[model samples]
Target: MKKSTFLVFIIVYLFFSISGFLFPFDSDWYRTLAKPDWTPDGSVIGIIWAILFGFIALSTAIVYQERGFGRHNSEYMSLLGINYILNQVFSYLQFNLHALFATFMDALFITITTLLLIFLAGRQNRFAGWLLLPYFLWTAFATYLSWLFYSLN
Candidate 1:
């Protein structure tokens, strides 16, 4: 992949990150819901996403830098980007979109996509793969949260 391609992807990710800032803390219905005791504080969401996206960016860059596996790596990279976008779109549903079921589905898909990227990267590049473990853990936790939210409210 060219530097331009990486730049474009980063720019797009940053756009989602910027959009996240506009979201008010999950209040009203969210607070009223019965969530797990381990459910993360809403205030931490932005920080966690920033850290996850940063690792994702690093893994994407590393994937592009490797030799002899461009084609396969590109597929995972594309999925990562697509899933990341889906993840952001899911957040919008928590606010404006009323499809709690669809939002849950999106969260599940995002978790699967994240798992796929982690598995593929783990096989191809250990560092890239390691970078995503935190994201995978976060998504796993977030998946439960999404399920809980939909279930309770």
Candidate 2:
């Protein structure tokens, strides 16, 4: 992987992370709404995301290292980036609007795209795919959580 690609990924990832953290922290009005039984504690969300982001960064590095899929890497990266960006929108809709049900749709979109990315990454290197296993699992869990939240709150 080129240094530039890692740099870009870090920059973009940090931007999303910071923006998401600050945005939710600033929105107390929405936080007051009822949440499901298993809704993660906000601080726990931060911790989990930090670790997850590290895994994502590592997977990006692995994909970039795969010389065989140079062209395909860009395609996979773009797909992953689109899903990441859409997730930011999901963050806003889920929290700010309190649109629990609509948020489920966004989560579902992410889950599908994530699964696709996992497949793409696997084609490049199994390690790359393995790195994303946590992401897939987390998103899958989040999907179920969203469904529960949608039904209850």
Candidate 3:
């Protein structure tokens, strides 16, 4: 990948990642909730998100590289846009609005979008699909976690 493309992807992911900080995790509210025993520690959660975003950035760059700038890649871009928007909404729903069920629904939609992304990207670029595996796995886990949070509290 070109340096510029890589940088753009990184910047975009970081921009979306900023949503978490903007809304901020409500420790007090979270503390009162009935979380599962297996919930990850704060540092671990940070590390996981960092790694997942790294994968997403690289995978998206590959997709862009393969598709190039044109109307041909519109659907791919649209899926990415939807996925990114949905991804941010989860943080807002859980941390800002304190809507656990809405968070789970958003997460479920994010997972489906990620899967669609994998499939669509794979048809043209197999590496892109392979790169998103961790993202898919993490989102799947997140969907379950959100559901657990809703069910418990």
lDDT of 2 by residue, 1-153 (tens): 578667755864675576467447434754665676567887787788788877777776677767433564677978877878767877787767778888788888888888888898888889978888888888888888888878766
Across 1-153, the per-residue lDDT of candidate 1 in tens digits comes to 787557844864586576476655467756766777877777788788888888887776676666433565577757876886787778777766656777788888888888889887777789978988888888887777788777877
Off by over 4 Å in 1: 1-16, 21-29, 67-72
TM-score of each: 0.79, 0.83, 0.93
User: Worst lDDT window (10 residues) for model 2?
Assistant: 22-31
Between candidates 1 and 2, the one scoring higher on TM-score is 2
Residue pairs with backbone atoms closer than 3 Å in model 3 (clashes): none
RMSD of 3: 1.4
Report how far residue 26 has shifted in candidate 1, in Å: 4.5
Displacement of residue 83 (Cα, Å) in model 2 is 1.0
CA lDDT of each prediction against the hidden true structure: 0.74, 0.75, 0.85
Estimate the Cα RMSD of every predicted model relative to the unseen true structure.
3.2, 2.6, 1.4
* Number of the predicted model whose TM-score against the real structure is largest: 3
lDDT of 3 at 76: 84
TM-score of 3: 0.93
